[model samples]
Target: MSIHLENFKNNLKLRLDDNPQLHGFQTFKKTLERDYFSEVSIRICFKEAAKTENLVIEMDCNLDLLEMLYHLQKGTWGGNLSEEEDLPPNSSFARALDQLQELNEISIDVEEFSLFLNDCSIIVKKIYSNSIKDQLGSILSTIAEHYVYFTKGLSETPFEIYVPVFEDTIPENDYTLSKIREADNQTKDYFGFWGLYFDSEDDAVIYDLSNKSIVSGDLYLLNH
Candidate 1:
């Protein structure tokens, strides 16, 4: 009596429908469109693996768009941070950027991401716990709750589908670009840009922003 793919979809739909507030999202089909230097739409979709049978959540976001948007919103495009005029603390854009910065400070684990979505294709076989529905519901709720803010964050590098990775994981370098192209080939598995290797069961991990490599530890620098 294991969970099936259909069970995951049904349960997820039920979870979203149960919450009346999320009706505006239209079951995650709607994309977030914005124009800073150019028009960009944050599109989300669901796909299941044909062979490995993994649930694949796909998001279309570009790092350049996010960086430009941040600069335009914050007025930090050509000048240093100190020279830039800051927005009010309560501004939605400012607040969203703050949250995004916080997310970047601590690397998020693939097993634990605080974001939501409307539709998801989850491979039942990959889920290790019995509370699969509950897990999906929580994740979706988080996504829907901060949909706009999360969209802003997604416009950044590494382009988090759920979990956040390093900026170097982007296709700027040959190594990373090759990896990205290869990932397109393996559509069945979750292709995390930066693989996590925990040295212990500690809550903290050292994140090096310079080289974009993570070292598990408690006291780590927020920036290089």
Candidate 2:
């Protein structure tokens, strides 16, 4: 079950066209042959500077998982991780995997995976799993939680990744400001922007900066 590459490209283009901020970006896809898993590489570039500063997303997955994503996106699969359950029981996709496991065609392990952005690329590692249930859970969870970051051009809006802090140890109004000041100093000292961090509760709190007492949301010499 290979990925439907053409469908993926068409759908992605539609998604990008719907967002004005994403108009500057263009997408290109490449397939890679690998012994362990299939690979689909999608490179997103700013239209004005297509040659350099491209953001690449590499998806590495086995045949079954590849098919799963395709089906999920197409709405052929019943499972939707945006629901409350981490892994929905009613998914025929999971049941099919279970059948394959029973036949010994595939063996599942405890799913372990990593998702990180570094050096202008986002990498989604293949989950190593022996349990089909755990593997399904992890895959669905990742898509539900982080798919937006991949679709949205994070490079254009670096502040989208900013986290705010409101700690009891620090004054309510000054917490985020203090953290930014600290980061600004580190950026000067290191000759590169220090990454932003804040209270865990502030993850993706992307509204009303004035209320948060944030005077500025600028990245100088920041690395992706």
Stretches > 4 Å off in candidate 1: 1-22, 27-31, 35-59, 65-69, 72-224
Worst 10 residues of 1 by lDDT: 108-117
Q: Model-by-model lDDT, in order? A: 0.27, 0.30
Best by TM-score: 2
**Per-residue accuracy of model 1 over 126-168 as CA lDDT, tens digit each:** 2232122123323322333333443333332222232212222
Give the runs in model 2 whose Cα sits over 4 Å from its true position.
1-93, 105-133, 147-224
Best by lDDT: 2
Model 1 clash pairs are 115-143, 116-143, 205-217
TM-score for candidate 1: 0.21
Query: Per-residue CA lDDT of candidate 2, range 1-224, in tens?
Result: 11122332232231112221222122211212121133543333234533222233344544343344455565444333346555553243344334434544223221212122221221122211222233433334343344334323232322212111121132346544344343322212221112222233232222223332223233222112
